[model samples]
Each structure stands twice: as C-alpha cells, then as structure tokens.
Target: MRHRFGRRVCITVISVGALLSSPAVPAVAEGAVPASAANGSGPGYSDDATLRGKIISRLQHMTVQEKVGQLFVVEVYGQDASTVSPTMAARNRALYGVDTPAQVIDKYKPGGVIYFDSRRGPDNVQDPRQIATLSNGLQTAALSQRQPIPLLISTDQEGGAVVFRLVAPATAMPGNMALGAGRSVTDAHRSAEVIGTELAAVGINQNYAPVADVNVNPANPVIGVRSVGEDPELVSNMVAAQVNGYHDGGVATVAKHFPGHGDTATDSHFGLPEVTHTREQLEAIDLPPFRAAIAQGVDTIMTAHVVLRSVDPSGAPATMSQPILTGLLREEMGYDGLIVTDALDMQGATSTYPPNVAPVEAFKAGADQLVLAPQMDVAYTAVLDAVGSGEISMRRLDESVYRILRLKMTRGLFKDPFVNVELAAKVVGASDHLRDEQLITDHTTTLVKNDSDVLPLTRDPQRVLVTGWGVTTTTTLGNAIGRRGQTVTVLETGTTPSQTRINQVVADAAHSDLVVVSTMNAASVNPITGLPTASAAAQQALVKALLATGKPVVVSGMRNPYDISYFTEAPTYLATYGYTAASMESLTRVLFGEVNPVGKLPVTIPHANGSGALYPFGHGLRYDG
Candidate 1:
C-alpha cells in the first residue's frame, strides 16, 4: 500500500510471545516498501517508544542465523548486485560461495554492506545514480528474503585526507582538521551536513565520521589531518555539532575509534597499538569528545583496537574489552547507543584475535555491529556457533539485534529501504553544496607566517611555479592561479622527489617571479626516532632548493602545518591541511588578497628538535591586521 508522506498512521503491534514461537515473517512483503523510507516523512517514526515496540516485535520473530547476520556489516566487491569483473566474481565466489552480491545477500542475510574506494579491489562506488541504483538493488535482494531486514549502508566519508568512497560529483568538504582550523562550530555543522546530505542522497544511511579522537600526539600517523584538533573541549564542541549536523542531513552519525585512537604512533590498519595513559589522563585528554558525542545522541560509537592499559590491565583492545566497552562506555558514561567495532579486517583487530575469532570477542565485549568482517564465512559461522553453544546468551544477542532494528526504524529504513535513483544526481554535488564547500575551504586556508609581508601579492606576478608532492594537488593549485591571469607552471614530485626533480624545480623557480612549494607530510616523523624520515629529506631538499632561487617563495603545507618547521627559511607559509580542489581554489584566492585568511592552527607547529611549539595553537597571521 502507498502511504502518503506525513500521514499519522498507527502501526499495530502483535504479541511478543506469539512472535517468538511462530516462524519468522518478513517485515514488508517484496515490492511493497512504503514511500516513507525514501521521503523521510514516516508516520509515528518520530515517536521513540512506538518505534521501540515495533522493533521489539520484529526482533522476537527473527531466526538465530538471521539474528547473527544482523550483527555483521560485510564488504561486498561490486557497485551492483551482479559481479562487475571476473576477478570480483572469483573473489566473491571464494569468499561467500557466490559470484554475485545478490546471491551473497540471499545466503548470509547480512544486516549491512560497506563501500570502499580501494587500490587492491574493485571500487564499490561510481557515480550518484549508479550508487543509488546499487543500494536499491541490494535492498531489493534483502527484501526478497523470507525474513527481510534492510541494510545499514555505510562508508568512511570523512572529507579531509581520507577521501569518502562516494568520490567526485559528491561534495568534498575541507575535512575535520580544516574545521578545527576554522574554529567555528557553525562551519563544522555546515560541512558535516554537506557530507551527510550527499551521502544520504546516494542511499548511504550511515557515516563513520566526525573522528572524535583528540589528536594530542603530533607524531600520530593516521588521525592527524582526520581529527578536529588537539584540545578536548574544542574537539568535543565540534563532535557534538557534527552529530546534530549529520542528523540534520538525514544520515546516522558515528563517533569513531573509541576510547581514542589519537596519541599513538601506530596506525591500527597495520599493527596493534597501546595507549598507556592512566584513567585520570584518559578522562582529561582522550575521552571528552566521545562524552560530548554521547550527549548529542550519536547513533553509533566505533571501538578502537588499541588497548587502554589503565582501564583494562588484561591488555585487550577496546573492541574485545568488556571492562572498557561495557563498564566504561556503557555503565560509567551512561551511553546506551550501539557500539560498533572499527573494521575487524584491520591488523589491530586480527593481530590479537584471528578473523574468525575477532567478531565473537567483539560481540562478547559489547559491540553491537561487527564491521568489515574480512573472513565473512568463518566470522559469520563463529558468531553463530558462539550463540548456539550458549557462550553468548540469547539476551545478549537480542540486545544487539534490538539496537540494530531500532536504528533502522529510527532512520525509517524499515518503512522505506530504497532511495530515489532519479533524484540522487540532483541532490549530490549540487551548486549550493559546492559553493558552501568553497566558503568553508576559504575559512580553512591558514596563513601561519607572513614574514616581511610577502603575502597578499599586491604586484601581480607575471610568472608563477606551483610544485607539489601530489600531482592532482599541484595541477589544481596551478589551474586556480592560472585563472587569475598569471603564467603558471605545475610540476608534481612524488613525496620523495629525486635530486634531478629538485634541480628542475630550482631552475624553474629562477624563471618565475614567485614560486609556490606544496609539501605532503614532508616533515612526518619516524615512529621510533620521533624525527623526520628519509622521504622527508627528499621533499626538504626540493623546498630548500626553491628558497635558494633568490626569487620570492611561498611554501604551502597541504597536509599538516608541521612541515613549516622544516623550511623556516621560506618568506611565507600557509597550511591548507588538505588539498581538496575547493581548498586549492580558495587558497589561490587568499594568495591574491581576494579573501582574508582567518584560519588558525588547530594543532601546534612544533620545533624541528621536537622540544616545544614553534607557533603555538591558534596562531594564524591575517592580511588585514
């Protein structure tokens, strides 16, 4: 039946006991999903208690295997239900005993699927219509099941350094650190809304974003540009704003890598890391943003794989620690929301517990959703066995299943699991979103050092050279500068530029009136030595050579502001924090004095010796003042 949007239709609830004893029944018959799900105007969906009863009724009727399946969100290999290529077909057949996404969904009946733009595998994203069509196809496969439940489609759409899987034609904002640099709560909310809106338009209902980890450690390899800032209070405010923003944009928000993935040198994707901070230190440094997130009623909080030595002396990562997940996050913090593990596929998760064992451990430790299960066959079976063996109590399983159902209901996934494939293109990457993104990016172009007023290039330099580590990044910046009627030359040197490339840039700089050198983590430290790497040495050589040209030089740190300390001899420095096309364009405008740069340092720029701050946090020079 076609339910009109906003109509107050009361859904009658059946007896829970009867539902438990009876054979499972589908929530909605095939080809009969209501329009409320797609339109976000479901009747009585806003009434939490009413939705709770409906979810409980559906939960009681689910089979044991279905309940277990509800806990997993697997990574499928194609943009659509059919396998895209022979390689993907073989991989899917081997992994799930099926060569197509539809067949895999039919067999495993997983609760959700995650999309990724990866180098090693087929990308699950193409354009907006294709993604929306894929989502609809998956939902159609899901609804065809005997006991249907919609999938919670998720992706890491965290704007900055980590590109959202949705790709271009989707609005790409200036990441979390850029928001931190802007230091405006409104900008944070707006940027998140833009991201969430674009994601939702493409039928992705959940985002693993608003990285709540307070990046106190400058040496942090992964979370540096992804995190908002170093201060807990600032991060907290930003996190809360994003939670509200994502909701406003019609997608569930996830505050990730709890209790904190910050303050560590290790990247969880590669190796296991430990946070040895005491309980006092953790509460003061690593947890305020999470607390703020919980307060904002975030839909899910993703567990980190790192061990908190102070909280759980057993040395278990947060994903497998009952003391940390249940005692700390659930009981002490009073957060009753869903706890999801951060990709069981990561080495940090699998290092201690194998792929088959990690999901069971994570569930036992109180995670509701087990994400990115690499070994789906083994992981799914292990969880099922754990439930059947009574090692995982039925009540415990039901608790997680209930949260998963409740999320679907709250998000109106139950009423309408599909998106309008036609409207997706119109909503995603719209003109307004791009404009707002540019405005926010403009606010994030931080002018850190403008010694002797080398900036606001009052005299229009006839010739300009823009050389950077990223090829597209340099091209984008050169294009932007070229639009301003300057003769621009663009050169891209991969992170470690050779001596020949360095000499080429210096020679080119001699011909140009002004040289712009962009560095990508050129000053990143070696984890053990807490000093720069050999790769940093190569990029530094290029920068030092450009500075020696006797011509005016502008060094732009495109990833992190810390690279400025490596080339202090340059007359001027700017921190874009990220190299989104919007960032490059906005940066070009700031260079020509078309817009005044107001972005500040979210994280302090430390001395080359790593002793103290070279430029303290909140330090940004302005063209006007």
Candidate 2:
C-alpha cells in the first residue's frame, strides 16, 4: 500500500524497545473454514439464516446518510491511553476531525478506521496502553451513534517493509518476497498467522496484506520486493497459504492491488501506471494470484490504482473503473467478498478524479470501502449527496453497507468491539513471537552470487573494512562483522558517496586484510538507480573504486539484490534483500559461518535494462553447497 516513491517505505528492522515479547497457523479443512469467511454467498455462509436475517433487519432501520457513512474506512491520528495528549492535539485536528477523535467517529460513523505508523519513528507501541484505549474509545463512539455498529479497525500490518502501522513491540515478519525465498508454504502460513494474530491483539482486525501482485517486470518500481516473487504460480501458492494463516489466526486478510500492479514502470503514487496486458496476458500473469486469494476465501480484495487498459478503455484507474472492479472482478471472477480501494490520497487516484468525487466513483464502480479518503469530509459528503440524488442508488449504497456490516458481524465486532489494554500490551510484542520471526529470518536470507567461493569467510581475517555507497545505518551490519573479533571500520557511503569517500574507503582497505562492502538500498526505491541523477555517478564510482583496490571484497546488496551485476567485479556477492536487524543477523551469521545461507531469490534481479534478470526468480547459492 506504500507509494512514497523515494522515501524508505519500510517499517521493518530495529528492536522490541521497552516491550515484552510474544508469538503463525494451521491448514484448511473443507467446511472447517469460518462461516463468516466470505461476506456474501460464500461457501458455508449461504444457508446462514441468522446472518442473513440480521443484515436485512439492519438495512430496514438505516438511513441513506447512515448507510453512506458505512462505506467509508477513513484514517485517524493520535493514540489514547485514556485522554488525548496536548502534543497530539494539533496532529489530531489536522488529520482526524474538527476536534477530538470521538467527534470524528460520532460524526462520520465510518464503518472502519485505519492507523499508520507516524512518519515519525520505529514501529513500536508509542504506548500500547494508549492504542488499546484508542481502540476502545473509537468503538465506544461507534456504539454511541444512533444507528450503532462496531467499527472495523484496520491497518497495514503486512509485515516486512510495511510494518509501519503497528508501533507495538510486534514482531516484524519478513516481507512477502522474503517469505517466498524461504521456499516453503508453511513459512508463508506461519508468517501471516503471526502477523494477523498480533494485529488482532492490537485491535486492528483487517490487514491490508498478502500482496497478490506478480512481479513480472523487473523495472517495476513499486511492487518489486513487496510481492512474493516474479513467477505467478509460486506467488499464488505462497500468498494463498498466507491468506489461510491470516484467517485462522483471527484477522481478515486483504489481497491487494487487485488485477495486479506489477509490470509497470511508473509508480501509481507518482502517476497512474497502465497495465497494457490483454485478457490472456493478465489472466496468465497478473490475475492468477488474485484468483488464488479469492479461492482461499480472503475477506477483502483491495483495488489497484493502476489502469488495466484491456479491461477499462476509459483509462480510469481500476479503483474507479467499474469494468475492472465490478465487471471483471465481481461478475466474471465470481468473488463475493468486499472490494476496498487503495488510499484515495495517492496521485494515481487524485490525478484521475476530483478529490471529493473519487469515493462516489469507486462506490458506483462497486468498492465497499473508500480507504484513507484524506479529504474525509469531502468524500463523505459527496457520497451522501450522490445517494440522495440517486446518482448512486439506495440499493447500491445499501449493498456496500450490508457488506461492511456483514464484515463487522463476521469478525464478531458487534459482540465485543473493545480490546483489553493489558492483554494488548503483552500480546503486541511478546518475546516468543519475536523468536518465531527470527526462525523465519533463518530461512529467508538468500545469497544470490558467491563468486570464487569467497563466502563463509573460512579465514577470520584480522582487519576488515566494511563499507558501501547506499548504506543507511551501518551499526547492525558493522556489528555483525565486528562480532567475529575483527577490527571492522564501518564506512557508510551515504545514499551516494563522493569520490573522496570511496578513495578513503580504498585507502582504509589497503592496510586491511579484507574488504566487506555492505550495501543498503533496502528501501522501496533506489533513488540513485531508480532515478537518473548525479547520484548514480557516485554510486557507480564508489563500487568501481573499491574493486580497483584489488582486495577480495564481499559485496552484499543489503537491499536490492541486483547490486550483484553492478558490483560484478567483487569476488563475492549476496542479497540480504532487506536492511532490517533480522536481515543483518542472517547476513552476519552466514559471513561468520554460524548459519548456512539457504534463501532463494524471490524476485528476479534484472539487469540495467528491463529485458531479463541477472539472477532468475529461483536463483540462490547456499554456503553448504
């Protein structure tokens, strides 16, 4: 769901902070799946007379305005242990409502609300007590409404890079691509269950996760590492396992960027990206994983902002395209679950429709929720106006609300909407959960290329110079090297280093016994390679100069694995795939010969051009080999 382009779009890495520790699921038995798993006419729920009766009854008492309100799942700020703080007051007003969060909750009566990690810091419970209180307060306000309904609290707790939303000491599970490298469906299942369980504990029930996008295009700026892998079948199988894990663990799972966001050069956040795939192409490449997610009984399918040229000829992004969201997804695919649009604040959506009209357009196009409608008041008013004018029929408005209510009901929100603060504090970042996450890290770190067998360092070289051009925090990677008792000089060649910095690194390496270059492009987009600028020069120069030292350098692409082709001169190359502490732990263990590297590349590391990958999807090298 992240589209910030160059900004580090990940909330992974770091530690448990001042929190306790904790805590994935089992398999699918035929009718054993939850009856409320799918909203409408889903497998075992069709004959649930009580569920149907409740929905019909609720519809009769609801007003058009109330029904319209249910279609929105807006974003709100501030965490409340008991009362809102003075410091949070300013942001609360700017983001949530005219006054307090409760006022916004009572006025909008949005069916759900999502929380994102503050652009502020690490993903930890700024205060677990505060969030638990906030959840209870929001639910309290929902019940206070005339037409009372429980709020479906949601967030992007998708693990890996996007773990930003949950600030509790929750375990940062490896991203989807990392789990894919583990090459086990069980790992995928466990990862999701762990994530879902923790999210549920925090009172955020719906996870906008298990990205179903197929990373077919190597140059794809957005979906590259977020997706499971480039191959459709592997991505489908792995994601489907994760879906079951989420459901079994008690949180609703969302299969995102529906119809797929892969294969595009432009990021939808910056501008709309067009998917020129014909029906056959889409069905074969981009659509299968979503097809798998639907079959797996996911609670919601989030629409992509990208336009499917073959499906919607109007060039409208799929979030507002009836042809894609309604026609292709609902009618053709036979998916009865809810459809939620990606955040409307992104330019992909803003570029196509007026801010106030996007929700109405998406609703008419058949989306159940208008996610992160930043102009919440405008979006809400427009939808309400459309309903009154019959531009959006009462029947349509009722359908979405019915689905939203059904979702709340299915999740048992009506019965117990509030979360226990004490339980959440312990459950959010419980120690055992962190261990399981470490187990996942055990299997997901891949070594893409270890040329001339320079890995597994065999010899404990005394002096090691570890540096890289794009490194962010060198402490973890540096500390790992230092743990070997080697005097490690960690040189961070920030974003793009200067020639002087590279020369200094080389100068330092001359007297060193070994040179271990740690690269960190671990974020979403590599501004240097992702953009054409002077920075690219610094990046290339740094690596070239290091190689000129004629030292046996171990180049680890701490972020993008493709740094291999760029640093082909190095005798050894590895793809940590992330710069998180867990990733660094995996890399360090392999370097010190503690743990054998066994991860496979989840996505193909393509060459400079978008033609082919330097390392194919399944490529990897193990230390044991």
Candidate 3:
C-alpha cells in the first residue's frame, strides 16, 4: 500500500568522504527540502550554516576534474550495477572505459546518472526491485570515491507516453492531456503524488515531469498529448498542482522545456524547433505555466533545445542561450533553482556543435546540470579544458557544482542515498497506488461523440469485435469486454496495417454485432511536414473499411483525440489519450455503463477540412447530459 506523507521518513546521516554509522537524523522528507534549503538553511537534511559551510569545505579540497564531473548527469548502458549484456558492456567500455554502471561511476565520477529503459534504446530498468538494487549499487560506487557525493538518480516518469522506463509495475497515468481534460487539480496532485511515491520507494530521487509547456500548436509532435492542454491558465494550474504532488510523493520536481516547447511543430529529438512568438505573446501563453511552477517552488527547470527567435535572436536553441536561461529565468523571473539542459545528445542541441563542445556551450549558457552528453568522457575532458583555459570561468563552474551538491543534500541523498530494495517490490505497483491511478484514469476517459445515443452498449450486443493499433492493449480491452459477458473477438491491426490485414479485420467485423475500432494517432502529424504520415493514412483506411461494414462502430482514440476530426462519420467516439491497461479498462467501463464519461477535450479537435474546431476545447458528452 502507498504510505501517507511523513509516514516513511528514514534519514541517513552523511559526511564528506565518510559514511558515519551514527543514528539517523530526522530529514525534511524523501524528495524535497524547504525553498530556504537552497540558500543553505533547511531542517532535517542539514542545519543551514553547517550545510553551506560543509559544501564550501568540500569544494576547497576537490580537484578540477571532480568539480567538472559534478556538472554532468550521464547515461550508462547497463541493467545491473556490475553486470551488463555483452553488447551493452562493449558500449559502456567504449564510452566510459568500463563495462558496468558502478565502474563508470568510479572511473568518471559523474555527479548524477539518468535511467533509460528501451524508450530510446537500452534498458537500465527491468522491474521495481531491480531498479532499487541498481540505484543502491550506483550510490555505493559514488560514495566510495575519494570525495564522496551521492549521485542524483533521475528518470523521465511523466506518467503517459514518457513513462516507458518505469511503466509496468509502476502505476501508469493517462498523462497530462488527460489530466487537463479532467481539469481537476486535486486529481492531478493525487496522480503525481502516487507516481512520485512509487518512484522514491524504488530509489529514484528526481523526476523530469509535470511538463509545463502549454501546447498551443495542434501539429506539435512531441508535446501534444504530453502537454496539459493548449490553455495557458489551465496548464499552469495543473503544473503547480503536479509539482507539489511530486514533492509530497518524496521526489524532487522538474518543470520542463522552458521558456516553452509548446508552440512548435518540430520534434527536438531529430531536428531543431523554433518558436517565433513575440515576447508579449510568449508571456501571455507559453510562460505562465513555468511561472506557476516557480511559484510552487519547483526544484528544477529544464531548458529546451528549441530556439525562441524573439528571446535570443542568436538562432541558438534555449539550451545554449544565456539570455534565456540566465537573463530571462534567473534575473527576470527570479528563478534561482537548477537549470538543466535537455539531452545534449539529441540532434536539436548538438547539430551545429560537435559532441565535445555542446556540454561546455550549455554550461556557458547558464545550465546548472548538463544531461545526457553524447560522449561523457570527451565532454568531461572538454569542460575541464575549457575551465583550465578560463573559457568557462571557475566562478561559473563552481556555481553549478554548488547547486548540484546543494540539491543532493536538500533531497536527502547525502543523508541516505540507498533504498530498501525489498520494500520497493511491495511499495511500487501496490494496490492502493493502482486504485488512485484508476480514479485519475476514470476522470480522463472522454466521450467526444456519442451520436444517436449509441454508447452505454445498452443494446447488449453479444458479439463484439475489438480491434486496434497495439496487440496487447487491444487484447486487454477485448478481455475487459469479455468479462462483461460479451463474446469478444480481438484483432491486432498494426499501426500501419497492410491492405490485407484491413480486409481481414473488415471481414471479421461483418460477423460481429458491434465493431469497436481503436486508433493510435491514426492521423498523427509528421514532425517536419506538418502532415499526417503514411501510417496514419493506412490506419484511416482501416477505419473507413470497418465503417463500410454497417456494424455499430465505436471509434476509440487511444492516443491523440485529434483523430476524431478525420473520421467525422463515426457514430460514437471516445478519447482515452493513452493505451495503458488502466486506460483501456476505464474505457471498457465507460462503454458498458459501469462508469460515466466526464472528461472534456483538453485541446480543440480541428476539422479535417481545416475550417475550424469540430470539437472545441471543454466539449464532452455524458450519458445523462
């Protein structure tokens, strides 16, 4: 079961270069310290004067290499601390001159480590217990160094499309757009708190979450569903709520992609995205959520790789724009928190600069922590060289290192960096957490269209065909319907199903009494062209083929709700916003009248003809309404 706040606070007392076996101190909390903690005064973690004094003393003794290492938070290719697949071992050896995560920490001594689990490639997480074990091992290695400092362990557990690293066995949320649809700050906080509690129990201390971007562009590929909604006010409210939730859940919060990544059509992963909003428009729309985040005292703010033409005019992404990061955020907004770069390895930030130069440039641009440098060893050395040549002043470098160490101390990492590995298995994916997640999911299953009152499955169609994009998710939904006493036939139409497969599904649907078709961003916009992909075309074709069969068709949108604008003729439509099992189950309940659909549209669904909104924001249909 999920423990209540202040119920499981276990503090570990730590001093530099030594593990004191003294009794535990009553730390502030698992994931956070007070806002004053940043200035060297917070209870539980450390006494204020002592905290600052100790960090200074430690800094005095550290070598230049060690100080430079503190600026980076790199990714290692390994599942376990000491063991890795042969291919992964080779990659690790090539990158860090080591074959395991623990060894990498010992050799290069990065201030932090970020976890990835097949979302981008390579798996550092397997299950809750394994993750806790790995975190403990990494901490042990970091502490074993000459100048011991506990590593900041972080992952992108944003709870929807971005939760791939820690999805299963960790409560899966319906994501930010879903929360926006619900429009309930209480639900948003509860959801993030549950996610945060589960992560902290498993030894993950930092979360890159509560995406503060107010997604204004419908064609935005990266931040579409991940964004809370297009409305800046609503997104701001949700962002603050989620920030508090994560902190209360025992993890530090990062409000991300500042000054904003919402108004672009480009995906920074593959190319540079430019946001051209004027400073006035930006303040009105894109910047409010981040402002709210700062008001909520968010632990960190991440820089986007997108360029804001009005802000810098240097044609540089915000990751390397000192004007945006230091001037706008630090000086203008009065945000004194850590500023981290979006992964430097991404094409968006490093396309112009080589691997070695990007990290140094990001530091020069006022980022406190450089995340995911492509080549850690080379980047580390480059930063060291730049500092040696006074290219990056020692004062600037020390400012970042102090923030890094301060964050570690405030988050209770120095006090107790290890987690109870055995308890992690029990705490994560616990029934209580799942129940809270289900409650949030229940609020996010939006009924966008129910023409002719076709929903509630009141006719009790005995034969139902459940077919969609993901095989596992499709089968899961079919099983849910089957549990409701329907004879359901499950078919997996690939994301871009072949014509033969579409034909096969159409034939199968003809024999069924009701056809439920789920689309996974069927009309997904291409990042570069701002047009739907061929896969989207194929998925649309499959839906059209099914509709022609004359069965009672229920089109379910499992990812983006915008797909509904394309198939305007569908009699019934629902937007789950995700394909997580919890969402599918909630969707099944809404279909069979077990629950009522209360979610509104977070973003406007543009008409296929490009005239106007087919379904405006805040539009939803309840069975009774």
Candidate 4:
C-alpha cells in the first residue's frame, strides 16, 4: 500500500578533499564563512546564496584532484557488506585511497548519486514504514561525515515502467502520455503534488522528470509513453504543472531532453540521434515546454543526447554543444537553473567521445552536473585539468555550484538533513498514496474504440481469452483477472511475434466469448533514426490473429496508444497509456463494468506506414451521460 503525504514525510550528504600542492585554488572573499555559519543573518539564505557560499567554501578548501572529484557522479548501489565492501575496495585502490561510504563522503565526494533497483535489499521491503526507515538510514549513512549541504537524492520516477518500487511509501503516478490525454493542467498539477509529496516523505529531493520531449513522431523509440503530448503548448503547460507540484511539495523537479527529442525515431540510451528540424521549427515546437518550466521556477534542466544540426552546426550533440546549452538554453531561454547532463555512460554520449573527455567538454558547454560516469577518477581529473588550464572558467563553475546550492537551500536540506525515521514509518504509505494511485489510474485509462457496446463486459462472460505478446502474469491486467475468475487465460509473446505461434494463440481465443489483444513497443535501438515503428511481422500476425478470433475482440494498447492501427479489424479498442499494476486494474474495471473509461487519447495514433494520421494530438472520445 502507498503512504499519505504527511505519513511519508515523517521518514526521510558528503565530503571533503585533497588540499595543498595544487595550482592556485580560487581565492574566496575574506571573512566569508560556510553558509551554515552565515545563517540567521539578513534575509536568511536564498537557495542561490547558500549554494554559492557552500561551493566557494568547498573550492577554497579543495585541492585540484578533489575539485575534479566533485564533477563525477558515479553509480553506487546496495549496502550488503560483501557487495559494497568489494566495490568500495576497487574505488579505494583505483581512486586514491577513497573507500567506504565515509571515505567516499569525506574524500572524493561526487555531486550526486544515481539509484537503481539492484541497489536495494530484501530487508528494506518489509513494509512501507520499514522501507522508509531503511531508505532514510541509507541516505543518512551516505552523508554522515558532512555538514548539511543539499545532497541530491535523485531517481527516474517518470511513472509507468520507470518507477523505483523498493523504497517505502513511494507510489508510481501515471505516465505523462496519460496526463496529456485529459489535456487538463489541473491533472498535471495534481500528479506533480502527489509524486512530490511521496518523494519528500522518503527523503528524495530531486526527481528527473516532466519529460519535455514532444511526442510528435509516433515512431519515436524512446519517448513515446514518457512524453506528455505532441503539441508544444500542451507539453509546456503540463511541464509547468509538474514542476510546480514538485516545488510545492518541497522536491526539486528537472525538465528533461532540452531542444526536444519528440520528432526523432531513435533512443538515446543505446546510441546517438540526430534531429534535423530547422531552428524555427524547434523553437516553435520543441522549446516551449522548457521555457514554461523555467518560468515556473524549475530547479534543474537535463540535456538530451540529440544532435540538432540546424540548431548547432558544430556537429556536436546538445549535451556537448556550447551553442545549444550556453547560447540557447542559458542566454536566450533565460534559464538560471542547474543544467544536468543525461547519463554519460549511455551509448549516445560514450560513442561520440572518450568517457573522460566528455565530462570536461560538457562542463565547457555549460553543464552544471555530470551524471553517470564509468570512471569517476578519470572524468574528475579531466575536469580539474580543464579548469586549471583556463579552458573552462572558474566563473562558470561558480554559476553551476550556485544553482545547485540554491536548490538545496530551498529544499531546507541545510536545516534538517534527516527525517524522523519512526515518524516517517507511521505516515509513509497511507490513504493518500492509494487515493492518488486510483486517481492516476482513473484519469489515464482511455476508451479508443467501443463499437457494438462490447465494453462493460457482461457479467461472467462464458470464456475470456487474453492473447498478446505484452500480457504476462506479472502485469496488473493479469493480476486483476487472476483475483476474480478462473476462466481467463493469458498468452505472452516475447519482443516480436512468430506467425505460427500467433496462429495457435488466436485459435484458442476463437473458442472464447471475449478476446483481448495487446501489444507494446518497449525499447527501440536505432542510433541513426529515433523512430519506433511497429514491427511489420508483429503487426501483421497480431491483426490477423485478432480478426480470426471471431469473438468480440478488444485490442488493448499496454504501451503508448500509437500502435493500435496494427489491429484495425478489432471492433473494440482501448488504450491504457501505461502498463503499471494500478493501470491494469483500472483497465480491467472499465472492461468488466467495474468503472467507466474516462481517459482520452493524449496523442495521435498515426496509421501504419504513416498513411493516415488518425486522432491527431489531443483527440479523445468523451462518454457523455
């Protein structure tokens, strides 16, 4: 069960460095003390002032090598004595005696930590409260040695498939595409508040979210379900709502993939992508959401690994292009927030330049934070050298540090680095969590097609056969059926389909009174093109199989709603913008007369082969009373 905001809030740091024997540390203003000491003077510290002072104090006390350490954000997970001990051992041996959480915190402190599921342990999952307690304990341990400076506890909580579930009391909200369906800024605001409140309860101060990429291209491999909508204005409004939601709840929000990744057909996580739109087209469509987010006082912006040839003719991706990051984002957009680089270890970044060199170039290009490095020492050293050689200005470093510290201050990190674990346990997963989960589930399930009144499935349909490559026992859809009926049967089709196998699955469905077909475009890897077109084989076989079922066939989209055209013959169709357990339950309720389908298409579903662009952006069927 999910926790309420107040309950979750009850639950839920680092380091120093080498000094002396380095070339000229930047001179600090005389009598300037650490921000903690300067508190209670004047208007108190705004996020900017507090952050500036902290960065300056660190710069004054840090050696060149230590300064480099501050630039590399390495990946670390888990607290199993055996696993962490060995990982720390390797860091100590390779990165100059830095080992243990204490040493990592005290010596080579990185700007932030990137968390994933593999890092969590079984003990942390006993209950919502226990999860909160364990998470708080883990964070507390990470920063035990340092004074309260805002340490960014970050995660990719974009809803749907990208949620981190191990932590206590943190409930996953609906994906952006679902929010976009309602086209209601109110829904967006509510979502942000819910997500932000849960994050605050668990001690997470930063969320890498509100994916600003416009989903203009239906075939976009990576951003289909993640984006809010294709229309720039709609995306902008929704982004602002999400940012405000996080801020109101006391967690910083990051607007991502600047300059847009909406029209591209490839996934940046696997390889480099190029967007060939002219500057005007990009400014008109791709940049509005970012601008809106900035206006709403978003704390951070994450750069995409997309290469926009028209925007930056320098032949470098936006993550490493000064013309895009410095000139366009900073100067033109008037954004003063911390600019973070997307994971540098991803092929999009690593494929272009050596890992060590990329961090320095990214900094030079005006990135405030370098995320996900393969070798922390190498990347850190490269940045330090670049700064020392005067290739990157100290002022630029100060600018980045100022924004980061400001965010920390705004989050009240300096005042209270730890939450009362026992209290957090009491409130972390309560009624509010469940309520928000239901709201998102209700608001995101869309009714794309309902012919012959097949929906609100008659009580106890004689035989129900669920056939799709995407449906499985673990999915919420499967769970919903498993709880009430024994007659339902589920079929799993891997990533792609086999004509022979699909035939057998469909043949079984023909005997059933109701047949539901599902498909998903989970991950695509085309470096040269960013499109995520449906597989021809899968599309053909699924459509053929569903048509052959003869029963009332309901084609359900468990991913983005775009691929529904593949099963054109189905009399009834529905789109659950995401595949979360809650969404699946909500979808089943609509199908089985449990709840009304209130969701509308947030984005257009283009025809196969890009023929007919049916249901253009913001098209959804409203069920009138």
Q: Candidate 4, which segments miss by more than 4 Å at Cα?
A: 1-25, 29-67, 80-99, 119-150, 163-169, 471-475, 478-486, 522-536, 622-625
- TM-score per candidate, chains pooled: 0.92, 0.89, 0.91, 0.85
Predicted structure 1: clash tally: 0
The CA-based lDDT of model 4 is what? 0.67
lDDT of 1 by residue, 484-570 (tens): 889999988889999988888888888889888899888888888876888888998888888877888899998877897888887
lDDT string, candidate 4, 374-472, tens digits: 566566656665655556655565555555555566677667755565665555555786677777678778888776678767566356776675544
lDDT for every model? 0.83, 0.73, 0.83, 0.67
Q: Model 2 Cα displacement at 110 (Å)?
A: 0.4
Model 1 lDDT-worst window of ten: 3-12
The full ranking of all candidates by TM-score, starting with the best, is: 1, 3, 2, 4
Give the clash count for model 2.
14
TM-score comparison, 3 vs 4, better candidate: 3
| Global Cα lDDT for candidate 3 | 0.83
| Candidate 4 weakest ten by summed lDDT | 5-14
True-structure RMSD, every candidate: 7.9, 9.9, 8.5, 8.4
Could you tell me the TM-score of candidate 3? 0.91
Which residue runs does candidate 2 get wrong by more than 4 Å? 1-40, 43-48, 81-87, 95-97, 120-125, 459-461, 469-472, 521-536, 609-611
Instruction: Provide the clashing-pair count of each candidate structure.
Output: 0, 14, 3, 21
* 398-418 per-residue lDDT for model 2 (tens digits): 667767777778778888987
